[model samples]
Target: MRHTWLICGLAICLSWGTSVRAEVTITPDVVYGHKSGLAMTMDVFTPTENVNGAGVLFMVSGGWYSRWQPPEQMQDRFKPLTDKGFTVFAVRHGSSPKFSIPEAVSDVRRSVRFIRKNSDRFQIDPQRLGVYGYSAGGHLSLMLGTASDDGDPAAKDPVDRVSNRVAAVVAFVAPTDLRIMVKDAPDRLDAYARFPALDLDLKAAEADSPLVHVTPDDPPTLLIAGDKDDLVPIEHSRNIQAAFEQADVTSRLIEVAGAGHGFRGEDARRSTASMVEWFQSQLAP
Candidate 1:
């Protein structure tokens, strides 16, 4: 079954087990501390029956597009797990330009906290959380999975106590290394302003990059990218996998032959299937 939140354009696709139906709540934009605000909200797909405690937290792409429409393909992409009994939370966050990457990253982090903080009401297993995304969304998912605990400890809200860490991450066509990404991707740089202009020095780059943060403690990651991707270069994902290897963490890089950044047509569908399988194997209870 497919669950959707109209205002936020969040969509959760349930496949393996029945999706719990719940009304989508639109919480007003509130700030996390003094920095990140609640311009973002989440759609919880609760199974109608007493929830069996299965679920995944998802973030959709928010690049340069005028509207942040959750791709229909994503719903189809995640159906495999949903069919098997995982409730999915399709999360929506404020995008670039209006907000900086740090701000957006904080918003994504806040969304995870929101879901876990209210996991009981949503009937989801907080500890069983997994995350997935595409393009910029994929980048955001990686941020949540990688930068889970980097938040400030001085935050006052009780929800700030919630951990944003995810058990697994599936990122499609994400630029793992922002330094190389800015050097090689002018188009994407134009899409998300400030990011490319930010410090690209070694120290700053490492701090801003997911690959640099990779440690054995990080959750297993599945990186999918087109070998011929012109926009974000497949090397970006390759570099990230290498970092994972150096850290002795589990990482898999699936290169779709002759495919571009977005993996159009049949390739897109196939990429989505691979992501579903990865999530199922890593996240299923």
Candidate 2:
């Protein structure tokens, strides 16, 4: 599977004093939460100038596998958002095989809550946080957007006392219904079926499924899917979009005609632009 770093072509300009520059500073390994003695971390990207103070989280997972890349690589991967003055957090969760999808979901939720609690430290508006990603990463984004909750006032952890809700979501070819995946899992010959992430049974799949929890208050979501995608069909996005509509939530699904699970070239560029535009509109004051 292609990691979603095919977006270097996106041109994002940052206004500086008297001149424009696009330099970004990365704060790496910022621990948001801990899981079973392991640190759940995110690398923060801040534009050198013209900071917008709106934060966007980039879900960095493929097949529920979250690993660390050098900070310099993130500067390339997240430059578009950073250059446009959005502070970007590349969030990594507890990976699969060792951990289940439910665990991954919990990790991301904790990450969001931690980030929200410390929003002032990062100079971001807690109300304007957006999340985006592709594949399993996209699935995680949907989970965040749809199943958000207000803080648990009685929770022991301060992070759990802050809401994990987000303002916007842009998920690329994400698997929306894990129940459907679970049903199809027996017949799947793909690499995804081999992964322990999709090892969930019916009950567990439904619990982690984003489509199951969508409500009117969920974030405005923009789902970009490939019509030719058989791995996670475009129907996944279509079905979720219909649910969003029924709930009177703002949502849109863009089906790229000839594209598959992963977009390329023009498709990639346009998809990214659409993501940026969605965030700009939804995160606006």
Candidate 3:
């Protein structure tokens, strides 16, 4: 749609000492979408030095809950990508207990479209965009990768005319198959308690699940999961890998030994490195 974006002046910050430093510019609270009269915003991090001409969208979600973290607070999580010359867009979606999963997904999709539609302003290639997320965010990343669509040319809104597809995706500890997840642990259904108004429709669940949308045209995906994860079983990644194989799509599954749902210490560092490498390889210009 032809929505309005309130982009503020760039705030520049230096990383490290003068000898080896990176000039990073951050623009916070750029409106991308609105629901219930509330604006959905994102923080855009652009490396003023050594520009890569590519962007990676990061979903800040855990347990289906999303909160906006300032650029300074997320420096550790995004420094790896920024150091590698990749622009980062940290997107925040509507949280649960007030919004449903479907609504959150829609907000993310709209954010992608907004970025693509205004890629020139960001000084990056629209087609070279990639996505990354952990836990519930990872699930949404896969959803975007598998279920993206080209915008309608007939739509009057220019943003709606842009495509939502990405070149690559990195999802960590995501639930690819919701049906299987609920079957394994019925109690997990409690996560969806916020959406009690919806009917119990199996077809809706199948349609919403990322596993059912895999196709050859889907973006190359890297699924990372900890073998010791009890919250989201490792089998979820395995099943997603199998689905990718069946669809003849490019996909990889990484199982971290002795790691749980949340990787820590060396494991966390390794996961971060792996994601940065994957994005560099897939989204590099």
Candidate 4:
């Protein structure tokens, strides 16, 4: 995949004695892989003052190929964190057919390394990094939390040495086990099986599972899921919470009664509030 990084040349000319305005840098569509030819991108939001010591957030969205752009609601969704002195990074990763879940996971790891390498320039405290994602994105956040530290010491890039481990993770309706997700996907199971491009080999699916990678050292995790979620079984979080308990890792789960795959009405508001609270408690100095 060949991707062009288009910085939307919005020029700024500050007058004498004027304050500098906040700016966002979008490294649009950079190819991270050569085989699947997959690429990813980021839209980074920075605070105008004292961002150097602030927390960092990498926000990824759910989409197997659709809904690649950030939802309009997310702007306000992110404001609270940024206002509280955080730098938010909205990332885009390749999804399905064009690439598999494993490939997408690798892309995310690469994106984290890229961000940490440039953290000083972005005024980010690399140690205070966090990840927040919804649906498929949620699963990716878990992967980053659990399986990110497998290092390649011989890698040429110095950024590769920076650990991909996050300080915390905020997840919504994340699928922990692919095998269970495949078995439980009511209407979409057949469609997914028929789609050869999905390339879901049993072994590969298990290998890509976030639940399979949990350890005692894993970071604190907050999971929010609807009890009636059809796409992601409620057992996904239940089992993960169970594992966390066994490992003595800090974890919490909030199941919204009667809520479906995604939250609705007040459910959405409460869920977001819980997530905000969790991140604040864990990521704040």
Candidate 5:
């Protein structure tokens, strides 16, 4: 009954059907960029059937720390999207302690540009790309969805010339405004002490916070969070959702009653379906 919950909240033991129904060509460790002489990587999963020419990026981050697992082993975990004809990319960024939040955000932005540049090869519309992740991964997802770039046409690198904007996003239980994360806590957070990425000056935190960047041009986003989540908290999602509405951006917030940072049983099923439907509606031509 344990399924690998892949996203920013860590590897959560949960319940989900693990039967791999969709066939896909699994390409692992595709280099998206290089940082400090190390290659940033993403695994590409292309469906063998029902090719929809749309791509979905799953941010492989938790607590600003990224991790990787072989793509072959995650077929079932990706089946919900792949079955919907989505080309899924499991994108990993520089981890915390070694790399900070600003660096992680920069890495994924480059990854988006990289993917958009190679859209023809990947056979997905550069414009139809979407993103998904939970918790810390969700934070990155919102960052991508909110603070996107038009790409410098005069940039030296061709990939950097492609826009980093996405078509849609599914940010689950993400901390929207990092600036308040430390101060609003009921007590001192041990996480801030342990995770260097969580500890930031107001300026740096504001610069990295997605809530600081919501705009009218932001792509439609569907946020799913548990009302009972205490780790990242539900207020994070609520605040961002409220901002989205005020900005007149197309958005939806699905609060899973009695759920937490991670979903299970019927909660997981509903959240997964919500993500799929959002993408289907938003990514379509």
Candidate 6:
């Protein structure tokens, strides 16, 4: 199923070859943040046409791990946004087994600040920023929506002084509660074990959980999950959706039937289409 999705994604990319090259300008390897001498970078994709003045930060992460994916590899996932003239920032953070989840979270926050601080240069409206990701990246996107902060006036760094808040969030197959997710999926326990701090500190893990921090001020969120998922249960999305409703925040959860941890074929296409429409509704100018 995953292989079929990859083939379809590749076909979509190939179909868009001429337009992608002519309508999008990709600036790769732009340093966004740094931690412990390691630089976190993002590939910025600006549409050369239409110019909507909106930005969507794409967290390039899975299982709390991150790496730089070439723009071509991401063309299918981000092309819908670019076609509508939204600039896409493929943000990469430090990986786990070396850097913990807390560190990775910090990196994502910093990336938000960095993007907002330089919004003018990127030709995007800082206030219209949105974020989306799948799996671990989805968790991070929720964190940004619920735990964002206004820039400190006294901060020495100008970037740190800018707000990290986003206008909207879209999460796919994400675990809203880390403790419950890890407890429920014993077979996938090794992924969380890579973060030594999380293994030793229960409170820290809870603090990082998105559902624990959601408030009324959180941006409108759209959560997509598979009803048959055995890895991260569908209950995770339902719980978060209920929490958002209690807080008076707009939230929607779409459970794809017969799908597992990953969506493929029709499910995959529907998921991507829903994400694009959600962002357009929330962030389009």
| True-structure RMSD for candidate 5 | 5.5
Show model 5 residue runs off by greater than 4 Å: 1-22, 182-188
Query: Which ranges in model 2 have alpha carbons more than 4 Å from their true place?
Result: 1-22, 183-191
| Tens-digit lDDT string for candidate 4 (84-166) | 66777777665565666777787778778877667776667777788878777788889898889844678876757666778
In angstroms, the error of model 4 at 175 is 0.3
TM-score of each: 0.76, 0.90, 0.87, 0.80, 0.90, 0.89
Better of 3 and 4 by lDDT: 3
In candidate 6, the residue pairs with backbone N, CA or C atoms under 3 Å apart (3 or more residues apart, or in different chains) clash, namely: none
CA lDDT for candidate 2 = 0.82
Worst 10 residues of 3 by lDDT: 1-10
Better of 2 and 3 by TM-score: 2
lDDT by residue for model 3 (154-226), tens = 9987888889998999999887876644333355645344334122355555666899899999999999999
RMSD of each: 6.7, 5.2, 7.3, 6.7, 5.5, 5.1
Put the candidates in TM-score order, highest first.
5, 2, 6, 3, 4, 1
Tell me the spans in candidate 3 whose CA falls farther than 4 Å from its real position. 1-22, 181-201
Native-to-model Cα distance after best TM-score fit, residue 223 in candidate 2, in Å: 0.3
lDDT of each: 0.63, 0.82, 0.78, 0.67, 0.84, 0.81
TM-score of 1: 0.76
Give the lDDT of residue 158 in candidate 4: 70
Model 6 residue 218 CA deviation (Å) reads 0.6
lDDT of 5: 0.84
Candidate 2: give its CA RMSD in angstroms: 5.2
Tens-place lDDT per residue, model 5, 24-137, is 777777888888988888887888898889999999887788877756676677789999999999999999879989999999999999999998888999999999988888
